[model samples]
Target: DQEGRIVFSNPASHRIWDGVGIEELGQYRGWRAETGEPIAPDQWPAVRAVRHGETTLNQLVRIQGSDGSEKTLLNSALPIRRADGEILGAIVLNQDVTEREASDAALRQSQEDLQHSRQLDAVGQLAGGIAHDFNNLLTGVLSYCDLLLQELGPGDPLRSDIEQIRHAGKRAAMLTRQLLAFSRRQILQPKVLSLNSVVEGLEPMLRRLLGTGVSLAVELDPALAPVMADPGQLEQVMVNLVVNARDAMPQGGQVTISTANRELDIAQAGGIPAGAYAVLTVRDTGVGMPPSTRARVFEPFFTTKEPGKGTGLGLSSVYGIVEQSGGRITVESAPGEGATFTIYLRRHAGPEGAQAKKEQRKVLPLGTETILLVEDETAVRNSARRLLERHGYTVLEARHGMDALRLLEESGRNVDLVLTDVVMPEMDGRELVQRLRAERPEHKVIYMSGYTEQAITSGGVLPPRTAFLEKPFTVDQLMRLVREVLDE
Candidate 1:
C-alpha cells in the first residue's frame, strides 16, 4: 500500500487541495465532518479501502490544508486488486462542497428569521385587538367614576373608595397604552426635538429609578440635530432601556446615556432609508445576552426575567416606537460583555423647539348645545349621553352612524355638534361625516375612538386642526373637548 500513503492524485484533486500534490497531502490531517475529531490513519477512507480491502462511498470528511484552511469534502474510495487476489492500491474521489453547505445554512437562517417575524406580527395584532376592546370597557368605568366623583361632597365617606377605583382604572389604562405601543397602534404626537434635551430632562428621574447601587452618566452631543418623534414615547423608551439595564446588574453597574449625529449609508442603515440620523445610545456594564437570547429580545412577551418581575413588552414597545417614528434600533452584546442599544432616528431639518406648555386647568365649561352622540357600543354610548346631559347639553343617542343620520333627518332640530365614534358598523364615522358635510358643511364634528384608522390620521396623528377625543376620557376632558370644538 506504498507505506500507507497516497501514491497518486489527479490534477483536479491536487487543485482542490490548494495545489498540494499527493506526497504533500499525505502529511495533512483529517477530521470527522460533524464532530471535528481527528481521524487516525487506519480510519481514513483510503487506508480502509487498501489495507482492509474495503470499499467506501460518499463519506463526509473535513481536511485541513497546510495553510490552516479547511475544506469539507464528500469522499469515496475503492480497493484496486491484482489477478492473484492481491490488493494493489485504492482509488479515491473527493468533491469540494464547502460552498453548498454554506448556502444551505444561510437559507435555513433566513427561513428562521422570517418565521420569527411572522410570529411577532401575529402577537402584535392580537394585542392591538385586545387593547381596543379593553379601551371601550374602560371608557364606561372611567366615565362613571368621574361622574360619581363630581356628585360626591368633599367630606363624603364613599369618596375614598371611588378614588381608589379611579386609580385602578388609570393603571389599567396605562397597561393598555403599553400594549398598544408594542402593537404600534398607539397614537403619537411627534414634534421636532433635541435628543440631548430629552436625556437631560430625564436625568433626575433616571437617577432615582436606578437607586443608590447604580450610577448614571450622560454624554450628550452639543450640536446634535433635532429629531421628529413623540416626546412621551421617547421618554418611555429611555425609561425602559434604563430599567432593563438596571435589572441586568442586580448588584449595580454604571449606565451611560449618550447622543451623537450620524450619517448612515444604505448598508449601515439596514432597511431604513439612508439619511442623516440622530443616534441615542444606552450602554450598561451589566451581564449581557448570548446569541440565542439576543435573537428574540424584541419578540413580544419574550422575557428572561422571572414571572411578576417583568412584562417582557419593554423592548418590543421600544422597537415599535422607533419603527413608527421612521427609525431603526440595534443592539450589540455578548455573554458577560454588557450590552449597548442604539436608536437611530431620522434627523429633522428644523431648529429645536420647546415642548408645548401644559394648559392651565380651568373650570370645565358646561354647554346647552344639541349634540348627536353616535357609537356602536351601548354602554359607552349611554355613559357619554349621561355625561353630556349632566353638563346641561341636549344629547341625542344613536346606536350607529345610520341611526344618527336617520335621527338627524327625522328631527327638524339643528344639531350643534356631532360627536361620533370613528369605527362602527354599516357606516363608519368618516363616511357619516362625509355625508353630513354634503348636507351641512358648517356642522361641527369631533371624532372619538380608542384607535383610529390610517384614513382618519395622517402619519399616526389626527389631521391638523381636526378635533379628536381619545377613549377613556375623564369628565373634564370630554367637557373641555366638546366646548372647544363648539367654540371653534
Candidate 2:
C-alpha cells in the first residue's frame, strides 16, 4: 500500500481506460482538457498527491486510451496517510464524461442556430419592404433621365450633366437589387442544372482571376446529382466564395472548390430535412475567421474590411440565393485553421435538362400599336406613358385593373398589349388577365411589379412562359421586353 503502484482497479475504471490494464494505469497518459497541454508523469494528480501530499479534485482532462480512443474525464486524487502522518500511497477516481459533453455542445449549437435564423428573417422582412419602395423611386428618376437624354442631340452641352445624373440613378438601382436579393425578393428563373458542369466551366476563369498568388483546385464527384437553381446566381455564389477565399490569403495559398452528392439523415442534415442533396464546398488554406466573426458572416453589411473597402453584401446575397432556391449554407472556421463554406442544394427529382439559351436582339424598334399602361404610382405610370408615346405608340392609362377593364371594353379590346402592375389596390394584373382571357382569349398582357416577394416568386421561380418586367427596369430593358413580348 505504501508503494506508488496501482495495486487494484475496479471494472468500470478498466473500461474507461480501455486496453490499459490495472497494472498499467499508473503510467496512463492525459492532457489538460482546456489547453490540450500534456499532463507530465511526475505532475499527474495521483503522483502529485503521493509525492507532495497534494490534492487534486474534479480536474477536466482528456485521455487517449491504449486502444487509441480519445475521451474526456473528470479526475480526482488524494494522498493516503496513516495516523502518524506517514506518507502512504494515493487514490484516484475518474468519471468518463465524453458523451455528456458532446451532447451539451450539440444542444448549444442548435439553440444558437435557431436564434441566428430568427434575426435574419426579421431583418430580411424589413429589407424586402423598403426595397420595393426604393425601386419605385428609382424608376421615376431613371426614366426621366432616359427621356431627357433622348431629347438632347449630340451637340447639346447639357447631355453630360444628365448623363451623370443617370449614372447615379443606375448605381442606386444596383444597390436596391442587391437588397432585394438579400431579402429573397429578387426574381429568378431556376431550372435543373449540373453542379459539376458549373464548376468545370468556371475553372479557367477562376484560375485567371486568382492570379499567381493563389492556386485553384477543383474536386468534383463523378456521380454528382443535378440540382435546381438559377445558374447565373449559382455562378455568382461561387465567384463570391472564391473571391472571399482569395482575399483571406494575401501572400499565397490554395483555394479548393469541391462538389459531391450527399445523402443525409435527420441528424446529419442539421436544420434541413433528411434528403438527397448536391453539396458544394469552398475551402481555403489561409487565415480563418474566429467564432465571433463566423456568427455574423452571413449578415447583410457585416464586413471586417476597413471603411470603403467593401459593400458587405457578398455573403448576404449568397445566403439569400441559396435559401430562395431551397438550400442551406454553413461555414466552419477557427483562427489560423482556414475556413470552409458548404452549400447544400436539394437534388432535382424531375428529368434533368439544361436551360435553353435565348438569342439577344439589341434593336429597340419604335412601336406603332395602341397600348394600355396600368400603374398605381402616378409618377411611374406617367413616365412610362411619355416614354411610349415618344416612340409613336398610342398609350391608354389606368390606376387599377378595374379601370383597365373599362378602358379595354370601351376600346373594344383593340389594345395591342395590356401592361399592368402585378400588385395593385383594387384588382391585380393576374385577376384582370383571368377575366380578360375568358372574354378575349387572344389578349396579350405584360406584368410588372416592384414588390416581388409575395407576387412574382412562385416556388422561387416565375410562372411558365410569362412576360414579366422587374421594377426599376431601364429604358432599354423596358423597350426590348415590350418589343419581344409583342412579337411573341
CA lDDT of every candidate: 0.83, 0.83
TM-score of each: 0.76, 0.88
- Ten residues in sequence with the least summed lDDT for candidate 1: 264-273
Q: What value does the lDDT take at residue 404 in candidate 1?
A: 86
User: What TM-score does model 2 achieve against the real structure?
Assistant: 0.88
Q: For model 1, how does the per-residue alpha-carbon lDDT over 281-348 read when each residue is reduced to its tens digit?
A: 99999999999999889887789999998888889989888877778888889989899999999899
Clashing pairs in 1: none
Model 2 poorest 10 in a row by lDDT: 18-27
Positional deviation of 39 in candidate 2, in angstroms? 3.9
Angstrom error of the Cα, residue 26, model 2: value is: 8.8
Off by over 4 Å in 2: 19-44, 52-57, 269-272, 366-370, 409-416, 427-445
